[model samples]
Target: MASPIKLHQLRAFVEVTRQGSIRAAARLLSLSQPALTKAIKELEEGLGARLFIRHRQGVQLTECGEAFFRHASLILEELRAAQEDIQQRLGNIGGRVSIGVGASVARTIMPEVITRFHRAYPHVKVRVLEGQLVSMIPELRQGELDFTINTYYHASFDNELLYEKLMEKEYRVVGRCGHPCAGARTLQELMQCDWTLPTPRGSYYKQLVDLFVSLGVMPTVSVTCETFMSSTSLLAKSDFLSILPRDVIEDPILGQQLMAFDLDLPLPRATFYLIQRKETALTPMSAHLANLFRQHCRASA
Candidate 1:
């Protein structure tokens, strides 16, 4: 049987179609114009079809080329998927996986997750990017990161992204060990004090905001911090108050240094969710790391 057409031909075709000029495509592909022309001629001969029209203005794809372009994109994507699958199968889970996590998850949960993951698969390298929910989905879509842990809501990529509920925890009003809000009796009473809050884009923070709106009052935010660590750290040293999940307050390191105040009205309950790219298959290492994260969250609960 004749050998399959070279990937170089497909690459050349894709570049030429995108660039819209053989000379431009040749420059983009780092090939001489004549060499590129020969490659395209050979490809069209093998395929038994004309793929492009040469013009003084620029090249235009033939009807067949348009269809071919669509197939070529799918082929390249599948090739990537296959490469990742093989790497996983070979048990070479040493490649980098970029993950995004909310500030709270990074502070309260990721330490244990990372430690256990590394212990089991020391070869795999993990890079965790901490950011708000607003940026997480965009970053994931851009292929800048693999997955993230955030609150599950209506998402544009809901069909292609998996959101797994990790756990549920209640909110607590917390302040520095010496802050006065630590002794406040009710929402009305606590409202009298200054507060630190995570940005409204934060899933929990949104709930916090809605809870106040429902109560016919909006709590005044004294300061806004980007991450839980920064917000909590600020609460540790200042008289400012912040609302946090019960799990974070219950954490030994943070719990010992902060105090939770009683509130007259109940705060909204928050559910934590783990967001990941939908995968029919993943590298052996990525699957293991994901499993490790789930296992650890279960253990913590």
Candidate 2:
């Protein structure tokens, strides 16, 4: 009978794949080059398939190797979680929970959620990863993040994940306080003003463009920003206008710095969603954090 695969072999395979070379992986793993090669060879032989294509430069994963690498990485991550869980359970409550947040949600809702959670579980480490959903989804799938809170996109539904609607948000066109067009009551009047827009590549930007096009106007974009915080800061000190969610504009600190345009144009409503891998079970701490987020959203509404 074939021997069962060993943990060391799996570790070596994953490290080699990550480092993209046996020498670097060997240095990191503190294993001799020959021993690492032998471990990989044994693992491949045990599985009855080649795992990597050896080359003078390094090694590249075969199709089978790529598939194995993903599983191996996930398995190692779960093992680490299990160890941490056990350690926390044995002593005071403490484990790490990593979450991804979008720029808008991060500014509006995360403050309350994080403050309450940290106060309740001071020992537990919390990590917040901020970025666009496109950049965060891969990390979420790889089990690097426990969950993500972001504006919902239709493409998010294309992934095998569970999405729960947190709230429906309406956006307001905003500019610096006492700006020339802050009192503009019509879309046509506001269209002439230079706007700071979300990056043109994002779904939200497309929605903004579609909203303006439907109104027979093409927005004059002066700048594009990936985050609401940056745009809000710019709008505070400049005459640039940008669309922002009601919660974000109403934020106690941010609200003081900007004024909303009174345009009657129909704008797209944004829905925020809490997303997680459907198959992965959330840790107790992660589940608690999600609950805190839900509570904060409800209370704010």
Candidate 3:
């Protein structure tokens, strides 16, 4: 790769190109005309290109200089953003923070996250994206997402991201209201009916499967849905039971017509965590928002 271009040289070039004279550029830069000239000459030498023409009418950029200037401005702009982002991290102030979350957490925690973040920093914008835990890890590593809420997939992964347990949530069996098995007491009785749990490969799908396995029964799943809304809708239409988090099963709008019952054999209790890249430094706003989330969880607990 080529050596990085110097910012001083670019600034001098931009000043001279805009002002049309070394004397004018020097005045603007608070430097002597000879110093400005020398800087431009060094810049051209470093790049192995002639950047300007010295004409009596005034200076004009060579084709190479014009292209370099365009890129130089963009680099400077990005540098500015990086500097500001770091400063914001040093002390909470301003910056964009991107957070990814699982469907379950999004439903239970988003309102508090948004309300508290805005109350503290009205100027800083928070962007929340929703996805399964399976997609969150890759997105965080790629810098597409700054942080996320997920479970420890494995011991290796648990050591990779900075994971903090936020809460432990239990899965309850849910069905449309007035369903005959809504009042069922036994896991065997519930497992005999059709089910709409997540597919085995989904993020928390294994929790449901493991539950039935421990009971020495296989769930008679008739359909597998990827999202909570889809599975809930299926349950409302047919006599299918689903394993859902308490938040969804208690949602007034979505759960009003649904009945939730505790499993006779204990269902899996899943841990939800707040995670961020171990190597990435959190911006001030991001860190502040994270603190607020922790406080909210503590208060709720």
Candidate 4:
């Protein structure tokens, strides 16, 4: 039988894993090196595994340690969240909620959502992480982000995430007001024009590329921009085209310079969701933010 793990052992394990050295972890934890080492030793013994292996530089997590670290770190975060939740219930509302937002929701609803959130939780800090869903998954699994409000593409689903579908957003081939392909109605016609595709290699970009390849299209992808803002700017000034949800082209500010052109071809439709780790129950602060996002998406739809 394995020894029962204690909170002290977990804290010690997580810190040591983070600091990459026992001495540094001990300093951060305000404990002596021997105590930290003993805690780590006991943690490894309890789990019946060698958590770390030492080399000339420092300690590195073994394969087992790496797996344990994921759960251990999240356990610590959950405990912190629980303590904060109780404090907030007792009228102390002063914790941060970190979240990820894709362009679909952020472009139209973010300002209003933030305004509403600030009015209710004036003391709580809100951290908004911007990127495509593919880029933010690791953080979600690691509990760095409380949750995400974003659109889902074909490859965006993960076994570790619980996805609550919000709404389906039809996509269109978007272009500048005077784009040569502005009146284009076919994929082949749009393929002749330059495009500003997503820069992220693994997620949306790869999937888009895959779609293009499957359809016998090698779009004249002239430029690749990472953020929607940059790509929107690039699209507004040039003849470059991109596939965007209708709301982006219909955005009050962006609409001045952009318009969506229909195609006989069917574009990939986007479905937005409230995405979170399967085991993570969002703290009240974050849950409220997620609710605000859902409300906004519904109202807009």
Candidate 5:
């Protein structure tokens, strides 16, 4: 029978893979290089695969190493989370909670939410990666992100992930203050105007597509930018117009510089949702933060 893989072996294997050198990993783990090598060898023996190829320079992960790294990393992370969860449940707070945030949430709700979260749990680390919800899915699947508070998509509700609707967001096609197309009442009139829109894929992009399908004409695609902050900057400096959250104009600095066109057309509202892995229950600290987000979303609506 294959020998059982030990936690120490996994630690040594993963650390060596991360550092790319048995010597470097041993130093970090406070073990001798020979000991680290023995651990890696034992792990390979247990798994019946050569996980690493050692050379004079360092070491390289075999295909098995690459696959096993994902599993091992998740194991260590879950153990860490379990310990943190117990401590937090016992009224001790000092663990990290990572969440993926969309541009709209990052702008409006997050400021107050983060302020309150920090005040309540000063020692706990907060990782907020701001981007498109679609881009954060892989991280969410891998447990790198505890959860994501972002736009909901019908296709995204799968066997591996669950969604809870937070609130719907109204979007507007905005431009710089007093632009030439400011009086336009329809998307068709803005066909000649330079526009920066979301990239041509995923949920946000699909909504933009559906909006323009009936118009029989499309806005001039000057840029395909996803990050709203950069798109807003492009809009403010140039004649580029973009579909932005209605609350974006409420930004103190951006408000004075940008104006939303009051188009006669009804724009789409992006509904925000809390997304998490279906099988993995969140750590207590993460769950507390997630609840805080939901409460704030309800209050705003």
Candidate 6:
């Protein structure tokens, strides 16, 4: 009978595929190049397949390697989850929970939730990664992120992810006090003002464009900001107008710096979701943090 594949071999194979070079993988794994190479060789021999193609610059996964990578990644993730599960079951409140969140959620909800969570689970570390949803979704699937709290559109489109709506958010047109457009009562008037908008790739940006399209007016974008904070800051100190979430402007700090104007036209409501992998089980710390977020949403509502 063939010998059982070792954990180190699997680790080596996965790391090589991820790093795309044995030298880099070896450095990451804290192993010698020859040792890492031997591990990959043993893994290929055990599976009776070539996992990678060696090249001048680095290596690329073969078809079989790609197939194996998915399962290998899941296996490792499951093992880590199991370890966390066992630790929590033993009455240890220590573990790490990684999350992907957007700028608005990060600024508003996460601060309160994380504070409460940390007070409760003092030993469990929480790591928050902020990015666009397009990039963060894959991390959630790969088990790198415990969950994501952000606006999600077309919840049914991605079957691999489970999206539970946390709350519906409304946007308001905002600018510094005494701005010219602050007196504008309708969407058409606001369209005439220069705007500081979010990056075009975000859902909010699309919503902004769709809003103007529905009104048959073109928006004049003066600047495109990568984050809500930047846009808010820009709006606070300049004549540029921006559409921001009610929660964001309502926050005491921002409230002091900016003012919201009533738009005559209805704006699209954003649905914030708690997104997670369909097949992955949540660790105790992760579930608790998620509950904290839900509780925060409810309390704020």
Best lDDT among the predictions, by candidate number: 5
Model 3, range 1-301, lDDT digits (tens) per residue? 2345688888898788779888888999899988888989888888888989889876899999888866665455446447768777577477677888777777787788779789878878778887666666655654556688755455345555787888777777788888987778877887688887665543566656665677698977778787766877888888888877877778888777787875566667778788886766665677777887788778767
Question: Candidate 2 at residue 59, lDDT?
Answer: 95
Query: How high is the lDDT of residue 263 in model 4?
Result: 76
**Which residue pairs of candidate 2 clash?**
none
Worst 10 residues of 6 by lDDT: 150-159
lDDT of 4 at 282: 83
Relative to the unseen true structure, what is the Cα RMSD of model 1? 7.2
Candidates, ranked, lDDT: 5, 6, 4, 2, 1, 3
Kindly report which residue stretches of model 6 are placed more than 4 angstroms away from their true locations once superposed: 1-5, 47-50, 53-57, 62-67, 155-157, 200-204
Give the local distance difference test score of model 5: 0.86
Q: Which scores higher on lDDT, 5 or 6? A: 5
Which of the numbered candidates is closest to the native, going by highest TM-score?
5
**Colliding pairs, model 6:** none
Clashing pairs in 4: none
Per-candidate TM vs. native?
0.70, 0.82, 0.68, 0.81, 0.90, 0.88
Local accuracy by lDDT, each model: 0.75, 0.81, 0.75, 0.83, 0.86, 0.83
Counting only residues 3 or more apart in sequence or on different chains, how many pairs clash (N, Cα, C under 3 Å) in candidate 2? 0
lDDT of 5 by residue, 1-301 (tens): 6789999998998889889999999999999988998999888989899998889999998998899998998788778888888998899989999999888889889989988989989999999998877788777766789999887455633667888989988888899998998999988888898888877555655777777987787887868887877888898999998888888787899999999999898788888889898778899879989999999999989
Cα deviation at 295, candidate 4, in Å, is 1.8
Ranking by TM-score: 5, 6, 2, 4, 1, 3
RMSD of 3: 11.5
Off by over 4 Å in 4: 19-42, 45-48, 55-59, 153-159, 199-222, 264-268
Predicted candidate 4 versus true structure: per-residue lDDT over 41-66, tens digit per residue: 98888999999998867799999999
